[model samples]
Target chain A: MLEGTMTSTTEITHLTFDVLVDLLRKIFVRHGVSETTAAILADNCARAERDGSFSHGIFRVPGYISTLKSGWVDGKAQPVIEDDGAALIRVDARNGFTLAASALARPTLLERAREQGVGVLAIRNSHHFSALWPDVEPFADEGLVALSFVNSMAVVVPPGGKKAIFGTNPVAFAAPRAGQPPYVFDQSSSAIANGDVQIAAREGHSLREGAGVDRDGNPTTDPRAVLDGGALLPFGGYKGASIALMVEILAAALTGGNFSREVDWSQHPGAQTPCTGQLFIVIDPARGGNGHFAERVAEICDLTREAGQERLPSDRRFRTRAETARTGIPIKAKDMALLQELVSE
Target chain B: MLEGTMTSTTEITHLTFDVLVDLLRKIFVRHGVSETTAAILADNCARAERDGSFSHGIFRVPGYISTLKSGWVDGKAQPVIEDDGAALIRVDARNGFTLAASALARPTLLERAREQGVGVLAIRNSHHFSALWPDVEPFADEGLVALSFVNSMAVVVPPGGKKAIFGTNPVAFAAPRAGQPPYVFDQSSSAIANGDVQIAAREGHSLREGAGVDRDGNPTTDPRAVLDGGALLPFGGYKGASIALMVEILAAALTGGNFSREVDWSQHPGAQTPCTGQLFIVIDPARGGNGHFAERVAEICDLTREAGQERLPSDRRFRTRAETARTGIPIKAKDMALLQELVSE
Candidate 1:
């Protein structure tokens, strides 16, 4: 199916956002995904690609198809929401994609946040294989603050540890700003993201120092070594390690999901997605009685840039999104061929 | 007053926790702190010292006295809690210590978390100078998960920024465990905390590499340079910078408090504490329908330790607490003398 194909030809094709989403939707449906779930995932991936989040965009499509074929994740499963009439909402994703669960729970989460000034959404038995910014940005666009945590497969070790006991756990946050797009950031607790390491290995590049260790638990800068039985180190030493541990507790333990170390998908040889859980905390800034919350966020962001911080998190993505909107999303010809191939496979 | 006096005499005095608290309370009362506020502040400081958090312990008593004398903080001010009958509670600290506000709002926060499955406490116009772990550990002891954020004075610069735009912002988390004390951690987003830098400067030690920059924005390992006119860098480059920005938004902007950069104390010379904001998010883990929530937390923590991470965030602090309970808190002779002098003055 032309997986990981990069041709010498510099041919590029431009596709409108809608067109890309529709094409990806077709690909998902062709591989046993339900129409509703396909639509949500397609839009998520398309948005990431348009915003220049290449690792989570079409680059992950092959993995999704393989996992579906291996029956590692239920492509047609429906998420069940448990409403205790409180600020906390729980969702059993039935081993489906996390996006489906999140999409179904968004309305209830928003209502609770508006009513109670805060809300928590916990989803378990789900697969989250996309960028986290998309999971949270919508809440910010609606003028609420949102934070999310999700744990992936175990590919990272605790600081000074030999075994991989943690995932490339990520934390995401979004807040509204005055007269501008929302401020958003999604960061991995690991020194480097697993996707970046995979990309570097594919492109024959060495990793930055302190990023990961070899199979023997010795520090190395080789992406290939990290991919082959090695593991990543938490960023900023013990501080980041603490954050990674926090994410595990918030996302897995609190959500009644599997810890990264417990994801036993070896039976499904082609599975690429980690069957874990996700947690979200949403808050209404108006509850603080601060009518100027958005303005203050904008003020601080501007001051940061003025202080010589050339770019803020999601700055480049927003810029890329704007450019992509004006001129369609650019895709390599080889990647386009792969998408076409998947539709009829 | 014998401030900053470290005599060559090695004589140390062991004081029981209550005795130390009483002495500190007298000193606070002598410095214009109200009786109730003094009790709270004294207990907080005493706990820090007992837990081996020297930077936030009695070492900060002089700064507290100096700020009070400068009329920078309202020692007698009462915190007012605004309950919207939702999951969010707002506290106007009236320029008092954040510990007082947190103490006053604890009951309401706990009630809301029980009723709504989640609760948020936003405290504005507050000075949070003590360690954050104390603010969250109590909630965890009640079998709830708690997370907190606070912004101090702007001593940390954004990544690649010449000017200091963020505080030594800290995020603390705590969760219940089945067979041990609450899992807790409080860490600053900066490469080095402001108090640590102060202690290093006083003790004649160099800062760690990549910790701070001098007045001209040149990297320096001298702690004195970091204190004079220079700034500290965020840990882990841009990722830590993002966390610091999130803290500002949560603690200051959402709480209707001053941003870190807006803390202007020029008129109140000798004022050490920053009058800023603090935020807390508490959740009832039982709401997720995870009957074994505490057990799961204990499991993950055990796995982390077994993976070769010998020391967790609060490991040493808990050990120190146990040891101090039997041996009493040891204080240098000079520090004891200073405390005695403050009580008389």
Candidate 2:
């Protein structure tokens, strides 16, 4: 499957889910990860690809490998869960990938929520490289409302500041329906995600107004400026900034982890994983005694859908998931070759 | 305090907290509320005024009086709290003001959170006619992170629709610091709160771009259009819309209360309070063993305040609170007259 020379602007080829996951597994295992850990991480990548999150899929594999190679992430370390309280589960990630810790923590968290109406899971010392929706969607599938917050490396500037203060902290919420797919939404507090800005720079696309600012705090629509010393502004101005601060406190401060400002990237060079944090809160709606929870959710979906050309949140993602499931996921030819090369190395 | 005529831009007169609370207590008493319940509601009004939330202060007293007169809100009713689970307190508000119910449920809620690391209070069959911050700030004062969501009358439209399908649902969050006042924020999901739009319409002021749309779904900056046969748009487009939907589910549906769509305004012709719902979640930072939570919060505050010309979320509110406490709450003469008239009636 020799696709042409690796170029930034290359045509894409379809890859089966099995084949893509297999390649990711091989690449992770080649970097000295346990086969089980590699499989878990690879599953996360496959889900990202299946959901059309190309940036978080194969695009992030190299970064994960780099972190592992630099000894910034433990490939074989197991997560330890502590019952901090009746409704709280604190997960020590043991300096490994967050996916492993989250995988180990979710079932217990859900069980606690089911028994106690609400449960909170705080993960510390983990490297979260995957999209947040996957972490919360499973709880929603079990008929619970789930919210997830994660603080990453600081790349987003505060509302009026020139320097980066908060990470592109993301908040995700998911709620289940009776028969339909759950209502799920995952969004970064930044005006635009760094991954999207990088994609625009690579594709020669101009950003919309207010996407980011130059180094001197002046507004700019140039994606390259946002990537080079410039910082992405929060969405909706100060409102987004406030939410980011909340995430930083809840994920980093409350979880006994490093804040975005505390993550020193220079100490470990390229792809060095930061000691990050994640918080997941799951609530059982049944405890509220609202017997028709599913019907109520469906009604909301109907009202939102009937309100003009608007689509329900995560509708597009579910559609893409269906499409990718039928037709194979399309990967850039260059990315396909890079994955193979990483495994071979 | 007879300072001005009842004009659109009437000057206001200062009313001492004692006088204002006394007036509110008398009005509620005249309307047949129990003295304790009246005192609770009066305290809520005073806090709203002290915090400079005039829309939720005396400005809403007439509505409360009207609802009581219309026999929609049972002013003498008491809230009942049920321990649905280890971490959940379900409050049946008994068709009364939510403030009373919240006051009744708060102690248990705080205790539950302290014991279990998290607690949820779901309030049902209540008229939550005031600001959301008051519901969460008390928790924050007790060294807990708090979040509250409430759904009200349908006045805001969905993202693409011309008609209002959702209320200007509000979400509030607060976290405590050692020396500083708790970091607090209460924001409506709409581009602007309905009261602000009403004030702008009365003052003949144009709204900011993307505030709302006219009857035909054309974007308009005219506040009158938004108030008359038009609908307010959600902030940040679909992201705000999604949050509004979450509030609807969590507040109304999950609490076995009425959604904005389910509220039949025609049935309750004038000032009859619809049974609204509120949900509050509190988390104890001690659960995660994060001892420096206050310092971490302060660091975030410094970063945001130092970044630019931006004020911290509740800084202005705290200042207003201090000013109100010192110089007394300023109330429009006409509103003062109305309150007196209601009490006399």
Candidate 3:
């Protein structure tokens, strides 16, 4: 489905998901990430690619490599888990990637949810730069519901505000459904995602109305203007702004990590990752004694579709995942060359 | 600030909060509600009025009286709590007001949050017809973070769909702030709240663009059309629709309550309330070991305002509350007459 001709006759390269993960893992390890952390990061990025989340896939590798080379993030840092035998578990990522920290704490989080009926995982001092769905979907796979929030570097302004004080904060939710993959959604509080803005700027495409403001804080459609000292607006105006604020509180304040505005990578010129925090809340649906939880989810989903919502959130991604599983993940030949070059650098 | 001359002569009545609550309680009791349930509902409604949330306040009294007269909801049904000695607590509201069930379960919920670091309250078979802020704000006042979701009758449709299949589902959140009132926000996933639409319809006002659809599922700004066989649209297009879906899953599916689509109130002619479910997830921020959780929350709020946001969610309500405490809650003279009539009915 992703097959497309690049220039006049340039062909698209297709690779198995495993092959893509292995290739990306080499790039990460070469950029100073430990083998363990590289595997996790590579798998996450590859999964995004395999699921047609191209913005967060290989499109983000250069940022990862740049941030690592700038010494802003500790690619080899070991995360320390702080659990007081409570349902809430805290992890100090020690300036490492959030994926690694969450990976390390997953078992404890699952145990807490199963035993206590609900569990919360708070990770601090970590850099998060990928789609949040990859973090929460696995819990739903285990028959539990999960929600995750992550705050990024400030690139959004409050309504009618000129100064940027909020991030493109995203909240993701996942719930199991009967006879199907989990229902998942990862959406940014901003009208448009930063990755999408970057892609728009690269492709010289205009943004939608209400998507962003230029440097002067006036609404603008030029993606380049939005990238150069401009900022994004929250989705749905004030309602969406409130959500962005909530994400900051949940992921940053509650987790004891830096707020989006506090992320300053000025000294590290090439640093692109936001060193903030992330929070996860997982609940065991069985605790509610609702034996038909998954079936109910499926029912609502089917009803939504029947009601004329042509596509539900994650529908396209799941469909793409299946198609790619058979046809292999499609990538531009030039991008493939960049990955090969990244492996050596 | 609420004082205004009606018809150029009619005066606005002012009453202390306690006086308003007492009047409302009498009204509820006269309409067949038990004394205990009446007191709880009265306080909630009065609080909304005192805080200038008119939609869920005195404005709803007539609907309550009508529903009571129709014998739609059990005015004195006793809610039963089901405990499994886990962090999750289920409360069968027994077809009664949700307020009573939540009040009955508050102590246990608080205890669970304190002990387990997180608590989940699932209330099913309950009628919720008021502002959600009143439900979660107190948790923040107690220095905990709380989130609540409630689904109502199907007065909203999925984006671009003709049929009404979703409710104006609302999600409320609260968190304590340093040296200030708790930060709270209650927002409907719909573009505009159902209550607001009702108010607009009564006040002869037009809805904002994208607020709703007409009986034929065509975009409309007419309040009456939105009220009669039409439906509200989700805010922010697909993103808001996703939130509505999540609320359904969290509030109904997980709580073992009826989905919004399943609410069949045709037999109960005057039923204005949706007998569905409500979910509350409360967390002790201190459990994250973030000693300055409240202080951090305060910092971010201040920054948001300084960045040029004129007001944050619940700002007007909090300000109005303080003002009312100093002076009195302002009520239209006509509404006072209606209250008097309700007391004798």
Candidate 4:
């Protein structure tokens, strides 16, 4: 088992999926969350951990607890979906977890895409705390092309600016292949993800050049400089900055939610929610007719693999998913202790 | 007036819009292209030149003529649009320019989006010349969000492979604003466009580090090394590579067109057509009811400007467009000579 924290005397544990989900569900339920909401949160967290997204997995428990306790998130809130049309939907998340909100709207969303050839869903007043792939993968599994964009708290400095004016906004796209795992990808527009920098600082590692900048806007490789008031740079310079702007508009502006800078975190104090907006698009590829969509997707995958270079987008996640399913999830001893304390309280 | 090359004498020449289009049309028609096809080609090239896209403008005419003469492109071909449903269309470009095909498909595509909230159009068996902005900009101008992706001949080496397996696949996105020029962006997934590299090689300029690699897959800054047998690297590493794959799947795979490697230039001899596939998507933002779609797009622009930093996408395009409209377009000495020779022939 991996070591957790230096002060932890407890030994790390390997827990089965059922055990982990049970613990997560108990923790949320004890804290006033509805059984259904708790189950969704538990399943999302478990899947993140199982898929090796450590940042979004059990690592996020503390943050979720903080937000729920501070009234920033409604533990028992039920997201309501308004079907504006055959192809358009809006989910009023009621300041609930995006996981729960997306889950609530997914059935009708998928049905709409199947019938209409395309479906657009706008999610507002939600806190997105997990990886995006989990949200889009289900659609791909159903033989649809899916895209998602979400805008978060501002931490990136747009090109030509010295101050942070945009979020490390992220976009995701997924396409399905017959008899194979779908091609899926999610990426932040920032030069480096915030979690990555935090990990680098924890490991006492210097960042790659151009990852971020100091308070004065001079580039720095020091993770501390970036975390302590500095800002991350947009990836690929202005191209990435433009994409970040697109996401901000698509997610925040189109959803009638707060922009990255518009969210007042000072009011929430230490307990903060992303309080973000998200856009999810689903397209029925068959709508364009059976125009060799499956074959083309397969050809791309075969070419990538046959080239003997570059792993397919979902390769790692699928591998880790299998491993985690076969064995179990490993929880650091210190993290388990922290969860145990919450359970007792 | 710009200059024209005469070996012994170089004379500058400035041509108004009417003059350029007339010259281009005459040249193409002289090469056996139908008058209608020639006019479309001329209008697209003239617009590209006016917008400062030298690579796609007059620089591309010789290639178009070569393809027409070789019979690889049917100069008189008419693209047929098959409207399978209210939300989907497939355009059989009939071995003609994508510009002509898109023009033929634009009206129905826009109408479908306005009625159904979304529209998907796939163009197959077409040669895409000129910048992508012209295709998507019109949709944005009509108050829709437009996205286009096209895959060309492979020149970019996927990460971890020395051989080129992908094209300089480009994706363009445009969002309309109420009264301002739309937010528009077009980008190739390669570290540098092939044209840029060739120009650098001719100008004896070194490429930026990580732009491409030598034949052995070793990184190099020498443009000649990259232009010769070496291959261009995808921008932003794997993220860009993934996007390139997405474009390949959506364009080539979904459209049932040839993949990058599938196109054999040897068969066509001197005349080469991109002979590529393109996917276009148009979304009606108003479908997101009460989302303040136009206001949000405008807010994004206003915020970017009021933040006291950064040039918004399409800012330069608008400025250049206005200036070119007033002063006309200037052709370089050598390029002007080439055009004159084509016209005279």
Candidate 5:
């Protein structure tokens, strides 16, 4: 709650998604990318906004292009599948974009599930994924329960032994229903995700309270302190820390990818220790005699909604997508200016 | 932490587990349970203590036996497989002891996983099991990844809502490895499990600081008030509540069991409710590339161990299990006296 930076007359505006995405694709193409990569990047940028993850949308494109041009990411490198068979697959991103690798892995897992009734894929040496829900939606749409987890560079300290030792690992879960929004819960174990802090910094805002500690391990309210050596606090302290640890093991540890201490130290720039490791699991219901697992899932959804919670986990995003498709994208004036400048290349 | 009566003692010894179980079994047998049911009851009582979960161990038997005699629990009843098949299972616990039913479900899940590579079981209308780790360990030992969750009477309140709307849902996760104990982490989303509060109360000690709140939402150090109308604060506030909600859906909602406002309002003597639900999932490594999965998992374990944290997630449980096996069971002074009394009966 304390993390948003204040804005006065910077003048935020709402632009249609297509208009904005086209603008982004143009900029990415100008920055030296193949059409394929540019489209994915555009989708990554647009999808986040459409999904209400504006912080990871076009606001990040300037920085992304800078990194791409500086060789922190390859616009043309192809991700290599390290291993494949049965119900599992592993992919190496070859220092290429993670969205590319993540986008690449989701379908692979789904395909495996189609054949084997379950699927798992891990990715290492990849770029950062904007939001986990996007990567998992495709699977859920195919009538599967999907779970996703990713470990970031260390920003939060471990439980007792001090000093930062793990990242604000994020977890995304979705269960499909026949005629309703899936029960969706996506969360980061940290009090506030790292991207929130980065966004605050970009907007010149302050950090949320209890979100992080100063370099001294003493709690602080400053956003900059969190972005620096100051450690981010776990969501519910120990329980949150435990979840982060679980995600770290599953995403980084089990995936043969980088853990907290081993991750890239690249907050500002440089050849980062390939931001690595993620897990995608898809479970099919028809095998269990649950006669249309999705139908039962719909029943459960009705109960939750009746309890006064929202009906659809992804309803807001889905609505936004439908609206954006019909109307347009929402882009702020400053972001629009930046997009134009970056594309003038 | 101040949610229960409290007393303090110097230190407990290995006699604690066996002594407590002996008393609990006698109490259950005296309350009209068959000898086998008594043993199962005793096993749960002792397992909780052996695993350092004294809160659920013998400390609970007296009240549980009283509840059973009052017909709050079906002492002579058995779990019936209301539904079953390939990848899924649904058990009608028939109001039988949750421990016994869960114990019964473990092997079934493992057997199914052995054949299908993945298995799931949902149980409803059951009593509370002492702990979940004991439930999932067998599957882990069988070279499968296992996870189980249970929803109890409301303990954790949802965010932005004053009413208690979710349980301090407990989750247990276990995975197999080459040698050593299976990696396991059993946890409650609350700051301190409600059961832990009861233990502190009996020990005549004050609850730990910052553990819970009294009814007015004001911080308090009174155990009775904290447990009475006051609610248990989740481990990480909103994040903890979020997880409680997640489990509420997955374990209770999915199981078609009572949840949230639906649980029987009585955990004490002379009280009963139809409130209960649990879910168990097991994945076999053999079909999912078990060999490579194990190797990758081993590497991850190595990374955690090498980090030199006092103990990785499962270290304490592993150490305790080893010590128990070598030196017999652990017991406390008061518990031993209680056990002696029960044995005499």
Candidate 6:
């Protein structure tokens, strides 16, 4: 159910996850991106599928190609370290792609932590490429604790207000455990991201009630209601607002970038704003060099797991990725059609 | 109007807030505390009053005195720094009080931040003594961004489960600004804290519908039902659960102390746990010699204030504190009665 002149005449095809990722990588390489950069973007998309986060997956391939074609994202842009002292770093993304640059810049933070005890990375002036979970996963995969946040364009409304004054303000935190998957928690402060709403609209699905509101501040399930400057509701009212504010401070304020309302990442073709920021903090357990550290972490997570039936956080996703590596990735007809058109083009 | 507890037997003459605080300080000294430590505890209580947090104010004097007489907390015990580095410091509270020790230890953190750009202070074997905002406001006043959290006894249910597996874990963050007050946001990650439920119970008032659940996982408005082995829902469902989990890891895991299921700060004798942990992190905006950092924080607060009519975080309490300083402090009759007994003793 997307209305208006949004029409489709594309063909549909089902491709395996690896083949699709390879195809997407080739497309990114053809656009002048370096090999590492292309792989990072492609890996991000594949990980999105693995995590069941399709909104940020190959679903966005068409948009990515168009964004690059419009010169909104630089293919050859590089990130330069502006400051690295006292467990802090300021990285200039050079208007490059965010996922690629974040992938490149995150290890520098870990390197600092290896030398010292803790490290922080702040990236400025970057473009969106894919899901943020992949950016912080490696830190947890190693023996480190990590917290990362990215501030996007304004999509969520403040508490007791109707205006869209904050992005979904995505946040993710991960901690390592010995002999088990890391406990990774990631979420958007809003009930749902506007990107998800767009995906639903594209796939002709009705959105859940209370997920969004109309331009006049009336609650609506119609994705179109939230797209045209209508506000997205934050999850859990005041607490959600507090989280949104926290993300603003970490991702936008501390990093010296645009606040929520000043940035533009809407799906529209003409919108342009270059002021985005992100913060990544990594703490190495070995830097502190405690012997009983991993044991205690395992104890806590084991106690929690015994308290319930759920597996460790991201365990399901890790298992799913393994299964998807064996089987083909399931895709919606609409998404298949769009990817096919992109592959042909 | 409290239904059952408002009686002449519990009423006492009104005393100035300063007089009440002086009485508590004198008692602390009598129970084997130094004058300096006594003053810090009393001063923290007094500042809580100024910050308009009555529940964390002098109302807890009897509990402090009871714990002292019972010997669950050591009055003369002092915190020793067990480990020290530029980025991290671990302190053992020696079964002593947390308030005075924490207040005495925070300065060391700020001092370390002067050299290291960031500082962390972790305390184990401490007691809960005062409001969170009081502990963090000093850092903000000194132009540093501060965040702190403590894990309490299990009273909150984790997401998707009915068991009381998480505490009403509270995390507080304060950001400094030149023109406006430090934007302080302190909240318990529970639909309702036990303190609020106690107030409702004493007042014979029905609880909020969704605040707590009865023992059988059924929602109830009965405060007593929540207090007696029942669970308070996590604030914002999965978001609150995630936040509580974050606090647990950052505070307990980082500090190597007991977590939610292990914390016990109750005043009841023979039922407490000496396994409390606290985490404090301070970031110096002056580390980079960024002179405009404070004012930039002010700009963020101003934009938030301008964005809506809702008071900027912690605005009303600050105004209340100013009013109390100008006029006289306000105290409930039941609280005054307890204060009178303590002063008389």
DockQ (CA atoms), all models: 0.80, 0.66, 0.81, 0.53, 0.22, 0.37
State each candidate's clash count.
0, 0, 0, 7, 35, 1
Per-residue CA lDDT of model 1 for B260-287, tens digit only, reads 9999999999999999999999999998
Off by over 4 Å in 1: A1-10, B1-10
lDDT of 6 by residue, B184-210 (tens): 887888887666787688778888767
Worst 10 residues of 3 chain B by lDDT: B1-10
DockQ of 6: 0.37
User: A1-345, model 1: which lDDT tens digit per residue?
Assistant: 233322224588778888889999999999999999999999999999999999999999999999999999998999999998999999999999999999999999999999999999999999999999999999999999999999999899898899999999999999999999999999999999999998899899999999999999999999999999999999999999999999999999999989999999999989999999999999999975889999999999999999989999989999999998877888988898899999989
TM-score of each: 0.97, 0.95, 0.97, 0.93, 0.82, 0.90
* Model 5 lDDT per residue over B1-345, tens place: 111113324544455445546656777788777677788888777777776666776667666755766676778877877444445667777877776666677666666666655667777777774777787877777777777888887765544344565677887877776656777777887777877777666555567666676777666566776777876666775556656766766676566666755765455456432358788877665553336555555655665454334566677767776777666565666766675665666
Lowest-sum lDDT 10-residue window in model 3 chain A: A1-10
Give the lDDT of residue B265 in candidate 1: 91
Which window of 10 residues has the lowest lDDT sum in candidate 1 chain A?
Answer: A1-10
A1-345 per-residue lDDT for model 3 (tens digits): 222312222567888888889899989999999999999999999999999998999999999999999999999999999998989999999999999999999999999999988999999999998999999999999999999999999999999899898999999999999999999999999999999999999998999999999999999999999989999999999999999999999999999999999999999999999999999999999995889999999999999999889999999999999998888888887888799789876
Q: lDDT values of the candidates?
A: 0.94, 0.83, 0.93, 0.81, 0.68, 0.71
Residue B22 in candidate 6 has what lDDT? 78
Q: Write the per-residue lDDT of candidate 5 for residues A240-339, one digit (tens) a residue.
A: 7667777776776566677766765455364432377777767664433345566655664555455334434466777777776655565567776787
Better by TM-score, candidate 6 or 2: 2
Query: Candidate 3: DockQ?
Result: 0.81
Candidate 6 structure lDDT = 0.71
TM-score of 4: 0.93
**What's candidate 1's i-RMS value?**
0.9
Better of 1 and 6 by TM-score: 1
Predictions ranked by lDDT, top down? Answer: 1, 3, 2, 4, 6, 5
CA lDDT of A52 in candidate 5? 74
Residue A115 CA displacement from its true place in model 2, Å: 1.1
Off by over 4 Å in 4: A1-10, B1-11, B305-309
